[model samples]
Target: MDAKQYANLIDKELQEMPLYVFYYTQQPNLSVTTIYQYLTEYRRFFNWLRETPKDIENPNAGSISDAKSNKEIKLETLKHLQASQVQMFLKELSIKQNKQSTRDSKKTINRTINALRSLFHYLTVTADLNDGEPYFYRNVMLKIPLIKGVKESISYRNAKFSPMLYTGEKKRKWIDFIENEYEHTISTRRRSSFLFNKERDLAIISLLLGSGIRVSELTRLNLKDVNLRDRSIIVLRKGDKKDAPLIADWAMPYLENYLKIRKQRYQPDKSEQALFLTKYAGKAKRIATNTVECFVSKYSTAFPDGNRTTPHKLRHSLGTELYDKSKDVMVVATQLGHTGISATDQYIQQTEVEKQRIQLDKTK
Candidate 1:
């Protein structure tokens, strides 16, 4: 829905309805996306506002006629709304201790309330009115506290490292298919595509399977970033400026081949120094993130077991296998450029029930 039109409709509702309230849309500091979100949250509240009990004393509310939709009312006048009204809105947000009347998630409620609070705070701080009390409006807005968010779901530490994808033989099948067995389909479009991208495709898969770098990181590579002789490429890591290890032994040959093809195709800096280039005519551009996803998805037929796999899952397979071999969380974490060990622990942990199944003897 168009935010401007929704805001306009809400303003119309406020004007036609029996309420004396002002709704402002201007927030100079906010981004366009942020402004859209604030408007959407306010729109939700305003949709339910007409049905909500009016605690605020409004003289104009009595004069307005009732409409089927609250959107019919137009709001022009500005009026003071008390903290009690804000509290009433919060109380109606949830039905039970765990359930919400608005059916909004706690995270969503918290965001909406923050948006409301931020707007009011902005108004309160910037208000020019000084009727012997400079802090009056600001104090009213300060009273609007954040709606407490619900706790997150249980951690993977207690749960089994569930749904571990494309490991062992499954991992081999995918690798083999990409490295040797992959082929174009009978369709004209399928056969025509990726002719110039064969080496590029293999290199992408090799990087994921060998180095386990993120799709984003792969897309961000430069021509100078690779070193085939060293069999390592410097990868930008999370948080710190330190480089992550590039152990793409299998990927080096593919990278060299792709680079050779890239150099020949995009001779004399035609690739514009991007490590990966699109197969476009004339001047080629850098590969896109969505394009990388499409690149990985093109060979889903590689999974002979009919199980689905993704690049991240391949990354997970690398981290998981590393942990399985060495049982070192920090090693896996550092390899993956994870900021914390807690985030890395999920790759190693198995639930009690799942572990018990593995413990069962084969003779039984």
Candidate 2:
């Protein structure tokens, strides 16, 4: 979804949460996606507080499930929570298995901790009560530590991702497969839908691999954002910062092919300005980020050894490919609009890591 859609969802969440949460989520420069994530974490933590048994010593704290809603729970129950209880909640999260039946990763747990920390910080240091004082000086999240091995996790992630990249000749081959061969693999009933979206799908994946824009950035593009003569597209980066990234010459034909038919194929309304269009109820709408992810996953999984990768993986492919050509981290960082070279550094490391993995396999 776009930022506007997420903002609408955030407004609904605020209705169920405390007034303090509204202030917290409204702070300037916090992306709508970030605000939505914080609200999700808050809901999960609140549900845990409500379902857990009442404490023996805290007899008056029977407000657990009796409270009508999260707002009441936040006001009456949150203020009385002990640091031990917060720690126990983290412990439960550590062992909890998701719908996929896999334990939460340290990174996932750390995100929860960060969200809770933001809430507590807002309550303690930011929000002012009716009496012109902070909620309660005690912030339980301060006592909860984020999981360690974050640096190790980064390297581990790069190693796992290195083999999945569509670098070198593989990038062209992947795009060709989608354009020419992908229809044969699906059922006849599904082929019509597949053919209907063929050019649009190929264009989306090509742009991602060619320019390294985030999926969110891709979904936000309007018709005017594309500069055919310049071979660049303007994108809103993280924090709503705008930058124009050059598109690879090889990917331009797919983009042209899609644009030539976009109006006729989608029958977009005159007011519709989205660069990519999706038809809904016979009306054209800007494509959603989730829809982009779903199609990227589907197409990539069909390609040989594609491993069901994400758009972000395609982003890494572009980063590494640029690094290989320019042999400059600074160029990759600028192309990817990374604020620092730190993240761009990983694209350089991926080659060495892949070599070491190959050596280990040779030894085996």
* TM values, all candidates: 0.59, 0.89
Residue 213, candidate 2: C-alpha displacement in angstroms: 0.5
lDDT of 1: 0.60
lDDT of 2 at 175: 82
Model 1 — TM-score against the truth? 0.59
Q: Alpha-carbon error at 140 in model 2, in Å?
A: 2.3
lDDT, candidate 2, 1-364, per-residue tens: 8766897999888888877788787788788889999898998888787777667478576734566677766554666677788877788888888778988788888999999888888788887764888787778778788788546565787767776788887887888788888898999999998898889989999999999999999999999999999999999998879999999999999999999999999998899899998887888899999889999889888898556778989999999889877879999999999999998877887756666788899986
Candidate 2 segments whose C-alpha is farther than 4 A from its true place? 54-66, 74-77, 96-103, 128-133, 149-156, 353-364
Whole-model Cα lDDT of every candidate shown, in order: 0.60, 0.85
Which window of 10 residues has the lowest lDDT sum in candidate 2? Answer: 59-68
Q: What's each prediction's clash count?
A: 16, 0
lDDT of 1 by residue, 95-148 (tens): 424334346566766787787776556455643344533223434446777766
